[model samples]
Target: MQREPQVVEAKQQGGSKYRYRILAMLFVATTINYMDRSIIGVLGPTLIEHVFHWTKMEYAQINMVFKFAYALGMLGMGGVIDRFGTRIGYILAIGIWSVFGMLHALVQPAFGFIGFCMARAGLGFGEAGNFPAAVKTVAEWYPKKDRAFATGIFNAGSNIGAILAPLAIPLVVLPDGTNWQFAFLMTGAFSFIWVLVWIKIYKKPEEHPKVSQEELAYIQSDVEEGEIEQEKEKMSWAKVLPLKQTWAFAIGKITDAVWWFYLFWGSLFLHDQFGLDLHGLALPMIIVFLIADVGSIAGGYLPKIFLNRGASLNVARKLTLLICALFILPAMFVPYMSNQWYAVLLMAFAAGGHQAWSANLFTVASDTMPKKATASVVGIGGMIGALAGMLADFSLGSVLTASGKEGYVFAFAIAGSIYLVCLALIHLIIPKLERAKI
Candidate 1:
């Protein structure tokens, strides 16, 4: 039998802070990922109304294509990352997505709808790799106690990306909406710069010369139960998919559809319901995502507090998720608010709560599975979440086509309440959050 590597005792002064440098890279990558994906959400009303002249159903179809590709990519990319490791996997994933993201500029009005779908499909397939890679990176670099906070820190990039889109896209998209291609082209360019930086900086903790022995020991200190040997063995979808912990993670991800709704449809909902123009949409969307950034970081911190106070891993994670669920309850009232900012505040809470919930939810997979299998589990859950979002897109398209603004009531209701149901199912499935045998 192979002997486990010995962990060096960390000094009282603390070890090198190299893990944070790795985390910063993850944060930037996720920020660019979200910005590229969010360009459409920020530009949705303009593209639908002025440029593409797409019907609501046609617009939904475009989003559905992205979600479909994302779902499939989650299945494949997770396995690919596990096979190849994060450095190469991340480069391939981002390169494909970035090139395809820039391709959105080439879409013209003749067969524009189909063109948009094709572009979105490529973009979605590439974007699907972001979370799997990021989560796996966190699992590799952080101890179990610190994983949620690190995940939250990086995941907040989604909100930063969301916030930046509204502020920046408007500057690039001409007031008449004629220069929308520049919006895609400019945002897509950011990833290439990020890729260059990432190539120079990233390496595994054990392999990187810059990582101190103490930091490496600190990182390896809290190996999960059964994970020592398991980490050396290869994992597959067949090995992971049968575990109840996998379902708990996947079931919890049903809320991902709610998040996608907020990402893809939130702008359109604001436009149709409140008569907001492109400039008008920026502030509310920015505020919503800003609050979400707060939630992501704070939510990740909550579980650490619980852990420090002597809570079990299961308790800390689940309780944080429960609080997040309650925060989303107010979102059901959003569509009924007479004041626009009132609706924005309510949606902000929902967005923030989801980000917080997401931070913990991502941690759960790492908590229960071996480091080797973390990306695969995240991918499986992401695929299921994307499938749920696709269904919501199809359903909401029909609802909006028939009922117009009133359809938002149904959509908000589902978004606000689904978290509780998902949490309940998660508890039933994996009450103890036991480590997987595989």
Candidate 2:
């Protein structure tokens, strides 16, 4: 039997922080990922619905197409990344999504819903690889303990993308000469530049010239002494689906459904409830996503503090999630708040809580699974999450069609309480963050 490698006894090791450079790259890719996905959301009410004269149900149908495609994409992309490795897999994903994002600008009201649906579907498929590849990369580059913080740092890119979308999309409009299509064209083109940088810079830690010996040692510090480092065999969906750890990640990801709603609908929610136009939404949306940015980093670090105090990994991760769940509960009352700022504050809390919760939840895959299975496992979880988002989008559309802004009362309530239930379910499923026997 192979012996586990003995971990270095020294708690501290001085090293170059080259891993952070990789984290920065992941951050940029994720930022572009969201910028492309969210450009539509930021413009949904102002451009897609109002300017194009589509109904709420039509808008929901378009979002449903994206989420459904995202769900399927996650399932496929996870395995693709596992097989192809992050560098190539990530590049492929971004390349596909960027093309589709730019294609959105080419569609006109003449082509109508079918044309938009096709573009959104393609965008969702390509965007699905972002997390699976990113989480896998983190597993490859960082130790178990630092993974969450690193994930949090990079995950904040979503918010940065979200934040930038509202601001940048408007800037691209040519005043009297152009429209929303310009925003899609500009954001879609931005990713190709990042692709060039990523290709030149990214490589496995051992192979990269920029990574120093000290950093390599620190990166490998999690491996126990005498452990055999064999190449991991490819994991199949059949083999991975039965594992409780996979479900824990999946079920916990239901919260992302709420996030998807926030991403696609938050601006619309403001528009419906407060009569905010596109220009009116810029500040509030920025504030909301900016708060989430803080939550992502804070959530990532909060668990580390507990782990440092000698708590078990399970305790540290779950406890942070529980706190984040509580933070989101107040969001349920936003519909009743009457005061717009008060409602915005509650939404901020929920968004921040979700980000914080997400940072920890995403780390769970790498924490409990082998590196080879990391992307596949993340893909499995993300697929389920996207499906959940699809259901939420469908339901919200139906509800809003019937009740208008009143429908958000139901949506917010679900968003607020769903995380606590998910946390409970995650605990019931995994109980402890044990490595999969497979």
Candidate 3:
């Protein structure tokens, strides 16, 4: 007695399991991507200070340079990946970043400030492609219904990298005072190995021989008829750039970079302010980042809970992000605390909240754009964000130098509260976060 449409629906429901498998490999790729990028940050305070005798302000200046290079890199990588698709573009990105990640081991003090900054800058440029490609791939693989969760899983790789480095870096050694350098080399080798695995595993949705027809229908069916009717074909940035939605994503992405830039460099901040040794809270960023991983998925999923209960994705995403942004309030107090655990707890909460906000922010890109341009738009947004980070670092670098270790209270306070303020400004421009016609 079932109608033809009913029978088709049942058939479509038959192959839901394969979707998660496709998402799993993408998640692995992202984790490795973040891991390689962060290895240098962990080693920066200990190795750089020991070898080069640089002040905290000098290190801060170098971080600012990395941010500038990374900003340009994201702008370029997005365009390249948009034209070429994720496979070839991602392979190039992974290979370049990983090579330089290991290249740090070969660097000596004689290579000095410019050489180290160049190496970090090179790493930043290559690492720039990661988000755009990963976000684009998730759009290709998962249905709209599943995309938020998929984004959370893959995006959490940055945290996973932060987590793993503490354990992995401490394992490597060299006869010289260059044990940290060897850690960079080991991580670089690890990324190169990941390149092999990524190539073996990735395929286009249509080309994936193992993908069930049922799942394919599910993915295609989720593409709204409105999206199909307006412009089914992919458009370049020239066509997409004029839209307000693109700008919204750009603002959100820039805001996102601000939050994570804080995490990536926060270790350096603590090293300067609190005198945390390699054995203390400094190296435990792995544990700190692992805890934050919970926030990434939770932030993504929490909004869906609201949506399933009838809230708009726009409403749920922004409201939840506001909550995440507010987590910085406590972090402002950590720098002033006498007890180290208080500082650690405050930093953990702030980082975890940022990860949660990150999960939802990325989902906004996929939510507001076509799958084809999700990464490209995210790249544009990332470029702006990288610049914002440089500005923040440049200002903070001066503060650190003037006040010495004690100057961090202002840094933590300002960094913590930026998200709530940024989100408010962004919403004013793109009130509904409506997807643009591209």
Q: Best candidate per lDDT, number?
A: 1
Model 2 residue 126 lDDT score = 98
lDDT of 1 by residue, 1-438 (tens): 121333243251366879998999899999999999999998999988888889999999999999999999999999999888899889989998999999999988897999999999999999999999999999999888899999999999999999999999888786569788888877556788878888898888888999887777778777755565566677889999999999999999989999999999999989998989889999999999999999999999999999989999999999999999998998999999999999999999999999999999999999998888999999999999999999999999999999888888999999999999999999999989888877
TM per model?
0.97, 0.95, 0.91
Residue 388, candidate 2: Cα error in Å is 0.6
TM-score of 3: 0.91
Error of 3 at 89 (Å): 1.3
Error of 2 at 415 (Å): 0.5
Across 1-438, the per-residue lDDT of candidate 2 in tens digits comes to: 212223332322455677888899999999999989988788887665545667888889899999999999999999999888899999999999999999998888777688899999999999999999999999889888899999999999999999998888667663322577788887655788889988998988878898877677767777543322532477788888898999999999888899998899999998888988777788889999999999999999999899989999999999999999999999899889877888888998899999999999999998888887889989989988998998998899999999878899999999999999999999998889998877
Candidate 3 worst ten-residue window by lDDT: 1-10
Going through the candidates in order, what is the number of backbone clashes in each?
A: 0, 4, 1
**Residue-level error in angstroms, candidate 1, position 76:** 0.6
Q: Write the per-residue lDDT of candidate 3 for residues 1-438, one digit (tens) a residue.
A: 122443546877767556576566667667777777676567667665677766666777777777787888888888777778788888888777877667766777886677778887888888888888888887877665567778888878778877777667656743123566767766655666767876886777767877787767766665666553333354477866777777776776656554655555667766766676555544557556876788778876888787778887778888888888886567778777777666777777777787787877778888888876777788888888888788777777787778776667776777677777778877988888676665
| Between candidates 1 and 2, the lDDT winner | 1
